[model samples]
Target: MPPVSSPGLLDGTGALRTSVEERAARVRFRRAMALMVMTLLAPGSAQLVAGNRRVGLVAFCLWLGLLVTGFVALVVALVVALVHREWIFSMVSNPSLLLVLRLGLIAAAVGWAALFMDAWRIGQPLSLRLTHRRAVVGVNGFLCLSVMGTLLFGAHVVGVARDGILTMFGSDEVVGAHDGRFNVLLLGGDSGEGRWGLRPDSLTVASIDAETGRTVLIGLPRNMSSFPFRDGSPMAEEFPDGFDCDGCYLNGVSTWAQDHEELFPGSEDPGVEATIAAVEGITDLEINYWAMVNLEGFKDLVDAVGGVTLNVRQPIPVGLPHEAHFHYIDAGVRKLDGHDTLWYARAREGSDDYSRMARQKCVMNAMLQQVSPQVVVRNFEKIAQASTAMVSTNLPASELDTFMDLALKARGQKVSTLSLVPPMIQTADPDIPLVHRKVEQAIEQAEGGGTKAAGGTGRKPKATPDAVTGGSIGSLSEGYAANQAEDLGAAC
Candidate 1:
């Protein structure tokens, strides 16, 4: 007789055994998936049904509390938005509330991830068939890893928010809008190892209309001097004849104030206050908030967004050749990473400070126009981290939401720029009153429709302002590129 040909070693009996085992494996697999799914939907459910009841109950309670909080918050916001939009804005603008929200998000992330892992442990994938066991293990690992990664990232964001509030803010109190516009002073400086302290090179006032998101970036020259101050302010009393003290320049105000700290008397930030006074006097606008950035850290932010695309009109050197490797950032429409972007915003080898000012505006415009919301979300974690390290501001964290809302509105509109550089107003001895008129004109023009490319004196570089440059800041011949422009892109 031919050797018995059967699927199982013990004739057909083994085949039946194999089939029974497979059926049992299917049941186990289904149960495991079910537990995992339940844990995902109602965290801690699997544990409560199986393992440590106390731990499960606590986790479930915590999760329920979070859900209830979320529901309440959503309902409150909706009601507030319908009844009074300002109330909603105010609520979101509170620094304390924002800090709480950030921390909450982090807590939720960590806790949820832990619950997912616990659910996996309760699954007991080892009891499953070899194939089913592997599958269960893989799925549990994937879910736990995914939840942990996402929540941890959120926790990082919350940490960033905390740092931002702690290091950047001074007073949590918000200053109401003035003349329907909120004017914020922007200062860019560096305080790396070799540097002593902040020496703000770039100065601009972003005056935004509350109702309409129309904005005006009024650039002030660092070298400017002889500007007045807000009446009776400490700096004004110190230098009654304008900031006309010996060797005083716009950028020097902060240093001068630091040197003469006694003059401030119990003030929080004398240097910032002095600079604000100078800007207010020049622009004839009240400064509501001020933000400062250590430009060295800006590169990290740029990299976080992957990179920004810009039209490099001229060759920008990355570093000094004599001191280190001199690499020229080749000109043209190119995508620049953080390092290159920082250089683009700060490079001034053969270029004058005024020209760099114009270029800086162009970079701003590029970043504003180019860095889309999608890009921000895609690189949210990195951006949040970089922002915390780079920026320090007196604007309370609560007020950020209000600005963010305005920013969304302003995104669609044109951003008019007016740089107070050479030819139009003498940087060395600027006529304060005339400067005010120029700023007013720029704002009025922007609100009406749009301003001319920051033209007059600094005729912007002759480039097609198709989107990338938002107009030219201008080359040397075009004055200082962005000294003044109705349309920055067109001016560039």
Candidate 2:
């Protein structure tokens, strides 16, 4: 008005208006970038502020649920660990819950990822400048992927954990331990389908001292005969004197029980009960729980753990001596995969059953001594998968943590092994009193240390595996212990 407005260009009003509009566009782009950042940090926040209310509300609710769940889980785990660790193990090992958890994690992953993508759409990157728009698109995509990937991985862990619980754990109710210890009957069998219904060829009792975590491995020969059952047990009533029928060996107890399941009306697992009766009668240790590992299925577990390191004393043949591809794992400290480790543990070529039993003990010792927590964590998925397929146990999930703690203690201490085979206890005609004495002797020796982990008792530092593992197998009667000592390596 003052200068008498010139025509379009001279007026300059059009230019000023265009500049103000451009500034507003730039501000909008900046705000969009900020919103995208907020979305990345707190998924539903962007939508709740500037987009679809329903979607935002739902997304936010899910976020809150996950947050609360994670918090509660952490709190419960910590409290249970301090107050009653058994509950923690039991809850975590529950198969049904684990399955639900796995499915939920997968669903959450997909849902959250979808929400993130929606958030990107709401940002309306098309309205932004070319450079800013491209940048926003890239960030949004990366964040979506990151969130989804993490959740999916969590699902995998949950699945693996569920498999672990199912494979190894059973729904056995927790019963008080026997005689201040947990005597778990370990039965080695050919449990493959159509293998004559679980022919248990090997038996060992893993007697663990509840207080001290000290352990004694009492091996029973499958050919053992003339064994008595625990007093007042179903089997005891059936066989009043002992399992003394002609041609009846300890190994046949399960089959005999299966044939006459009517006798064990009170027992759901007649085979296990019969076997337990035989084991209890022979070892003189009350069986608290039991586990059966299929010998053929054991290779998968070995492979799952990335193979076991064994000191081979002699060449163990892989197949029938004459078959093609028949070879031997020559004597040495060797890390064997599943196939070879199986032969190492089961081979009968150039060896008697008793000798094979001794070798098997060596393999067990090697596995226990060499496998560490670090190794387990590294190959947890494989181990969980293999374990589920290979083993069945009557051990309650509630007791897993207790056993795990005991195992940790045992690793720091020396493990003792006693096999009831040739030159020790006569399998064909075992001297019952003497056998009991031997078992007592082993337990007494293990507990003599009196180092209760619960009391914060200090244990000897673990020995290096390298120094202890490689050697001639027959060089020591007990593979880990030289002859028999509380500390295995020191005695050697």
Candidate 3:
């Protein structure tokens, strides 16, 4: 009508309009994607730019407060670590602080997830084209899941750590170091069926320097007899002269205490108390705490740490000599599994108790040196489970941090060993005064940065023509090198 308008022209104009709409939709899609990314980087940033200023201000302020607090805390922690490291350890070891941290992490995770959802709302996804809306939904969903999943996982790990701390270290009674050292009684308890109550098959005193963390492992054979008890203790009152009776030995102290439970009135574990008394009497070193390791469960702990490496000088039998289904661990410098390692430490076939004792020391030293912090962190859950079943201790929970610090220090230093075996002192009838003297000297040497001669405290026994016996390098008569070595690593 007005100059006869062409249908082609009208169609071209409509196509141009359609193109403009498509461009707008593309812009909306990119805006939505940007909002989600902003939230990922900074939780409330999208709302501040696009919508809900009040809510955005509150969330942003809270986020900023948290960031500032975390940064300040980190700075303080670094300073404390340099100046007063124990303070940091004490804070971490506190059950109350751990619980608070667990709850705070959970709260942070929830709050952050909510902020991600809010950011998606601020992006105005509903106003975009159908394809753009779907894309925005996918991106927002991914951001929420990834961020929330990471936070939730962190919270779970913290929870596990808190539970483990509570389960393993429940004691509240704290004991101080004695004579510039902390002497801990390490008892190897055998409590399987057909065995007399929970008797200690292996006994050792870990005398650690309070400041330096230099340690001396004092091995007391389970077969030791005629040892006195701590003065004024229940066992001491019963046997004033000494624990000298028919069929009596150091390991039997626990069984004897259990038989006469009334002797230890109000005591939760009479066996441990009696054993502590015996250790104190024998070594003349005050006992700060005791840890009883379940020998059967010990294998589980070894497995948890992914086994241990050892120098097996000879074939070690897997089971009792008389057992029909027994095997031997071949001699080599090998990484052995839990089953073989347990047998390696406990085997008695063709080996005397002294040789077995030496093997145990080697195992102890290897574990101390090889099981680093990274190994513990990687296998944390498995180790926590195994430790609960394997060990029972009377050490206070508060002292855990102190010992952890000391353990780290001890790893770099050589471990000295003093065993009351063969040439040093007869197990059947030990020299109590001489035992005390040897213990004191060992501690003195450890502090003085010197170690006893390779053979041990006293005169060395005549070695047999054969050097290798059992799994150790030295014969039983001459005393295994690991049993009484200045540097346990070198001897093993």
Give the TM-score (vs. native) of candidate 1: 0.81
Model 1: per-residue Cα lDDT over 250-368, one tens digit each: 89888888888998889777888889988888889999998887788888888888888887876788888775666887878889988888888788776777777877887787788
Write down the lDDT that model 3 would get. Answer: 0.84
lDDT comparison, 1 vs 2, better candidate? 1
Give the Å error, residue 201, model 2.
2.4
Candidate 3 lDDT over residue span 1-492, tens digit each: 346444334453354234566777888888888888877787777788997777778878888898999999999999988977778778877888888888888887888788888878777878998888888888888888888888887778777777777877878999998878899999898858755236888999999998979999999999899999999999999999898999999989998998899999999889889999998999999999888888888888899999999988888888866778688888889898788888999998888888899899999999999999899889887887788777788887799889988887899999988898876788888999988878877777777744564433533333444687776767755677877766788878
> Candidate 2 regions off by >4 Å?
1-37, 52-91, 95-100, 125-142, 163-168, 449-492
lDDT of each: 0.76, 0.72, 0.84
Q: Can you give the TM-score per candidate against the true fold?
A: 0.81, 0.78, 0.88
> Roughly what TM-score does model 3 have, to 2 decimal places?
0.88
RMSD of 3: 3.9
For candidate 2, write residues 276-308 as lDDT tens digits. Answer: 888887778888888888787789988888888
Candidate 1 stretches with Cα past 4 Å from truth are 1-9, 12-34, 41-142, 194-197, 449-478
